[model samples]
Structure formats: C-alpha cells, structure tokens
Target chain A: MVSAAGGGRVLADQDVCVGAGQCARVAPGVFDQADDGLVVLLVRDVPAGEVDAVLDAVDRCPSGAVRLGAPAGGPY
Target chain B: MTTTDPGAATAQPGPQDDVPDFPVPRSCPFSPPQTYAGVRERDALTRVRVHGGKHAWLVARFEDVRTALAHPGASSDARNPAFPALGAGEQQVAAELRPFIRMDPPDHTQVRRMLVGEFTLRRVQALRPEIEAVCAEQVEHLLSRPQPADLVADYANRVSTTVICRLLGVPMEDLEFFRRVTSVSGSRTATAQEVGAALQELFGLLDRLIDLKAVTPGDDLVSRLVNGPLARGEITRTSLLSQIGITLNAGHETSRNAIPLAALDLLRHPDQLDLLRADPSLWPDAVDELLRHLSVADVITLRVATQDIALSVGTIPAGDAFIALLAGANHDPAVFDEPERLDVRRAQRHHVAFGHGVHQCVGQNLGRVELEIALRTLLERVPSLRLAVPESELPMRGASAIFGLDEVPVTW
Candidate 1:
C-alpha cells in the first residue's frame, strides 16, 4: 500500500498530521507545516542524501503522518 | 490489547520496582548516563522509575524515541489522567496550566500558532543584531569584572536573562526579581509544593505584566498575545498566562545552560575550536551538533499512550506513560556515527534536543540564533577564553529536569 510517487513519495497523511514540524525541521527542503501545524509537502522528489533525515522526520513525527512511499533508494 | 484505569497507567509493563533512577547519573559530564546507553543497547523502549516512583517506558533508541513521541496514541497533556508526572506535584502544576505543552492536536496547534511567528528563523534572524549587541555587552561585562569571572553569572546568565527579559517586556529594574523568582521552579531538590509556589509567584507576576500589556500594548511577546489572541477571544486568559509562564521558563533555561555547556565543550576540545575559528561558517552546524552532543538537563517530554501500540521493542498498552529521551536518542549510534567525540564540522542537522513534532520547543529557532550569535561574539571577543577552574571542580546544577551549571568559572 505504501509505494513511491514520482521518484519517491513524501506522504503527509492529513488526519494523522499533527504539525509538530519535525518533518520541516529535519528536511525543510522536502517538508513544511501550515499555520494549523499540519505537515505539508514542499517537494516530493526528495534528494538522495536527505533520505535518512526524512525517515527520521517521519519516525519522530508526533502524529505519524509522514511516510516514505517511494524512498529514493528503496521502500521504507 | 490490555487496558487500565488512568491511575493504574502508572503500573505499566515492567518489573515492578527494579529500574535505575529517571535522571540516570552520568559518570562524566559529557557522557550519557551509563544506564541509558545500556538501555539503548538492550531495547528500544524500557520502563524505568521516575522521581516519584512513577513507572513510564523510556524510549531510548533514536527511531523508537521518535516513534514514541510522534505516535498518535501518545499524549503530552499531563492532565490526561494516564500521563506520567516527572516528580511529585508535577502533575498538579502541569494539569493546572494545561498550557500548549500539555494540550493535544487542535488546541496545541492553535495556541502555538499564536506565538510561532515570533520564533521562526526569519524572526530570530531579525532579532540577531540586537542579541549580538546584548551578547557583546555581556562579554564586556565579563571582561571588566574581577578575574576568574563566573561565566554562568557574568556571561551566560547576563546575556540570556537580559535578552529574554527584554523579549518578555520585563522592566529592567524588575529583571533580577523575575529571574530569581523564575529559577525557583527549576530547583530539583525543592519539593513539588515549593516549585508550585514559585510558579504561582511567576503566574502572579505574569498576571500583572499581562494586565499592563492589556492596557498599553507594546512590542513584547506578552503584549502581542494580549492584543492578538486574547483580545480576539481565540485563547483564554489562563491559557495566555500559561503560555507566558512556560515561555519564560524555556526561553532562558535552554540558552542559559547551552551557551555555557557549548563553551565548556569547545574549551575542552581546543582543536575543534580552532577548526570553527578557521571557518566561521561552521558555527551554525557546530551549534546543532553540540545541542545533540550535550543534552543539558533531560528533555524527555512524557506522554501517555491513548491506545495499544507496538513500539518495536514491546507493545505499550492503553494508558501507559512513556517519555522520548532526547538525551538517549541524540547519541543513538544508528543515527549519528561516533555520537560522542565533539566534532564541530559534524553535519547532522536533525536532533531532538529542542524536541520534535508539533510539541517541539517553540523558541528553538530563537535558541539556535542566540547560541550562534553569542558563541561567535564570545569566541571573537575573548579569543584567549579558558576555564578559570579545573573542569572537575566546577559545580553542576542539582537534580533538575533541565540539567545546567551552578557557575561556569572562566577567564580570558
């Protein structure tokens, strides 16, 4: 069910997004948060080196809304 | 899935009475508690006893710690009946305030939004020149004072205290009173009642300040809140008070300790200092690395599981409490290679030092900017700075949630 979009997916599940901004903090180039504090995608084709930080963001997200549907190297 | 009553949540899956203390003692100042490292090696999450014999799972490994904090089932509201209190009477204070720190979702987002713009990188950048000026003034004060200046008092305290006071709109004359009153709550040895009383005193002071801001709005944070959210009926007066109180606590404490901690670490590793001095661009990255390397006073924000969830290591049933041990996570070997050695050129940007998720420190951007400016100014102004006393002899702060120093005696 979790698959990549384009080269990879930067998924922010709307309901689960709590907007703790961990995603934005970890990979600001790839993620951002709205005023209501929900994670927003800045860029979907996440760069290669930033993948670990992106995963770190998805993992640390207070609400667990983020996911690597199609991580650059492989599936998360 | 097992379920328990709120109070029974304190009795989570664990050996009833045999884990090491919550603020695990460190063998040396820079090292993570030996127990924490042990836990990280054994399991991603382990239950341990906190200050008041409260049992909560300790999420140690980097991935698991992040999983625990960001879990949908996890809740930070200490009032959540199930949430674990760090110490005696902590629940009372936490629940009473129900500040944004304790609130879940919508309320947390809403309350935090009211103050977010003030701390964004852009905002903190705009405030940098002023912070630099303050840091310069404090450095001058350190230079002028008697030899072997207490860096904690002359530099760290003066810089952070003055900057925060100005940001919060405290009158210059009242800064000493507010600073002294605010620190009473950070006392680890103090009883919960004593800390509560101190917080109440802070609330009262904030109340008067809020009232003044209400009548005559100023450029300060409290004034902005009074005129924006409170006046708009978006947030209650009590919520505003809690926000201000928590801000006052976090604003000064993180930097007050961090500036000194980073300085101490840099002094100990003069080679790293030389690297940073050679290339000033390394300051921001170095600051981030230090924040990760130094977990000043633990910031494992406790959360109660609202439902059963498999936490990689174990399944935490509904109503059990757990904390995201940033101190432990920062050093997880899986995340940061060779987590120990102080390398200023290190480039890992993501750290839970200011915390993560919607509940991350609101003032983190400000904290970072302050550190960057203050440290840069200090190194530039006082190139010969060194510890005045033996590092071992320097007194560390007592058992407080946020670890800090009593005095950082140093000299140029």
Candidate 2:
C-alpha cells in the first residue's frame, strides 16, 4: 500500500534478521511474521503518514535490515 | 580432584568453613536460588569455593571479579573441557548457534566491531523520544487494563521486546512468537528437545529470510551485512547466526529484569520514589543506581583460569573455573558504602552490571536509554503505581540466570 504522503518503497533484508520482532512491534500494520516467525513485509510502499514510524523502525533495527525509499521509489 | 603440585603455589582459601552453605547442585538450573548467600556476605572480592562435583573458585569481591573478567587467561570459550556446568543438552545445541558474546577477543572483537555502530550512543539517543513514547503508551495500556497485572510479562517484557525487535528489523506481526521463542530460550527448565525444536524452527525461518535478502537486498543491517564488509569472506553463515542469537538473547531479558526490579526497589523505598518523582532529571542516575543495587543477572560471568594467579584474597590455580558475582560485587562495602541501601543520588559510574572491558555488554547504552525512558514514563504516568500483592507473594527472583520477578503484580 503506497501512502499518499508520497508513495515510497520499504525494503526488509531477511538475511540479517535474528527475528527480534521489532518492526512488527513498531508498525504492526506493515510488518507480519511468517509461520516460522521471521518477519514478512505487509506492504512494499509506505504511505506518507506512516513514513515517520517506518523510518523509526528502520533506524532501530540492530541488524540494519530495513531501508526506506524516496517517494518516487528508487533503490534505498 | 588433585591439589596443585606442592611446588606450585597454594590456591586461595575458599569460603570460611564456619559459614553455613549448601552444595552446588549437579545441574545449573536458574530457578531455586544457587548457593551464593555465603559469597554475598563476604567482601566483594572474597575468594570462595563452590562444591558442585569439584571445588570451583567463586570470586565475590568487586575488584577481584573485575580483575578476573579482564584477566588474559579468563577464557570465554565454552569448549574448555574444565568448564564447570551448563543447564541442559540445549547448551551444546546452543553452542552450535553461539553468538559473539560467548567468544573471546579476536573473533569477539571483529564481530562486535561490525555491530558497534548500530548500538552507538548517537543511534540510541536518536531513539530516545520514541522510547519515551513507547513507555508512555505502555503505561497507558497498563492503566486501562485490569488490576493485579504482571508487570514483567505485560509491561517490562513487552517494552524490551518491542525495542529489540525494532532494532533487529523483525516484522510487527511476529513479535509475539519471537518473544515466546526467546522467553523459552531464557528458561533454564527448557529441555534440550524443546531447545532443539525451537532452534530448528528459528533456523528454518532465518533460512528463508536469508534467501530473500540474497535475492533482494534492502538497506537494512541484514542486507548491509550480507553485501557489505562481511561479504568478503570475513563473516560466515554460522557466524551470522551466532551474532543474531546473541543480539536476541541479550536484547530483552536483561532489560526486562532490570526495569521491574528498579520499580519494585523504588516503590519499596517511597523516599527514593518520591525524590525521583520530584526531579525527573534524576532518572539517569536513578537507573545507574538501580542497576548497581539490583544487579539482576546475579550469576557471575563464568571464567576459567588459564594460569595460576594470586590476589589479595587468595590464589586461583590454572584450569580452575570461577564466576564473577555481579550482585555480590555491587553490594561490596569496599566499592559502595551502605552496599545494600538504594541511593538514587549515589555516584555509581564504576558499577559492573553491564560488565567491563572487551566483554562489557555492547547494548549497555541502548539499555540505559530504554531503562531511563521506562522509569521516567512509568513514574510520570502511573503516579499511583504500587504492588498489588505483598512483596513476599511476588516472584521477585528469577529461577534462571537472569534474575527478576516472574510476575510483578501492580495496580495503577
């Protein structure tokens, strides 16, 4: 779901994830856990309203697996 | 077994024989208190012996324990044959999944360097406002909930888990499962079968995620680690798993124990609680004091002596193992005056709760930020927060290595 706040892409790197379950804690609507418990992104494009929260989650990731793209959508 | 050769130096005297004591059990379980009461009574640096099967040195003195921790011969390798004891077969399985915290020097240094930037004060500070907000939201949630709420399970545990999950880039929906897995891992009672099952399940999950990252690299730490410096034959798959395991293991439990203990201590001492309430600026110092006083991880960091070493208290011969008792050291009179008293204003920068030197908890700064926010927000939002049951009724001490209450029943 690309947010109108200027749709931007959010990439979640699965390799470095130790499954600490943080992104889900911060933005439950956007991040979901698979049956195996690893994180799965619910949405690729983040709305403007949720950008700040998503960015916050990105910054907090210990494994640095989360990245946010520009509204126009390019490589994070 | 056999005493040191007569020509060799005499080992340090252990606990005075006159002191009452109990045998160190065959298994190192976390529940029921381990026999550290005698050790606690001695000076922070007292040399004591614990009889499990053989005599094991117990470093209770603050200074001596610190010295032992930094000593060149203190080995972090679990592979050491002389290593005293571990909880279950899970230790072996867990060993295969070893994290950097369990490794010594060179490897530990390199792995930690990669993570050092992510946990820096600058990064942690950036999350301060968010941490405060999370604390406020949790407090509000608690206030709205039914009374006699278990603070450890509900608030403290949740807060730490949430923060750590965010740091690890895990998805939101998976937080509950991840928390459950980590909780089980933290328990000493967990069977090896349970541990293996959990590990297999976790690894399977990680495998898929790793595959995804390999194909579509993101800007997250995982992607960076996969493609960046670690890609050049420096880091391996097994090594990556180890780091992840360590990060998750340390991320929540330590903070979970510390937060409620600090709360309980402050609540028990209304004077300190009142002072903290009156001056929010004292929150940072208050946290340091609580860490020093509670020292929730009471189990000493394990170390095996590689060579005979002498100290003011006694001598520890090569091959003997010892534990640096943080709780005992924190209360050592030699280090802190009125060691048992909780003084929010006390100068406690030298405390070893996060440890010292190379193995010091890498997440200490992040832990402090989380703690300060939790304490301040809890006090501010739930001014009437107090234990719902008598202190005696509460499960204040952990049955495992990480000490804290099983349930902190509280009412707003």
| Best of the candidates, DockQ | 1
Best by TM-score: 1
Compared with the true structure, the alpha-carbon lDDT of candidate 1 equals: 0.74
Clashes per candidate, residues 3 or more apart or on different chains? 9, 25
* TM-score per model over all chains: 0.86, 0.75
Q: Please, what is the whole-model Cα lDDT of each candidate in the order they appear?
A: 0.74, 0.65
Fnat, 2 decimals, each candidate: 0.22, 0.00
Model 2, A1-76: lDDT tens per residue?
Answer: 3355738887787654434345665667677544333458998778557876786566445445567765543544
After superposition, the stretches of candidate 2 with alpha carbons farther than 4 Å from their true spots are A1-76, B1-37, B40-55, B215-220
Which predicted model would earn the best lDDT?
1
- Over B1-412, each residue of candidate 1 has an lDDT whose tens digit, in order, gives 1223333344543554566556666666776777777777774356666666767777788877777766667788877766766656667777877877888877786777777766655456678889989998989989998988887778887788788878878665644554575466665456668877888878887889888998998888888889888999998888888888888777887788889888888888989998998898888889888888887745548888887757666667777788777888989888888999877776665778877666777787688889888888888999999988877887776565677777888878
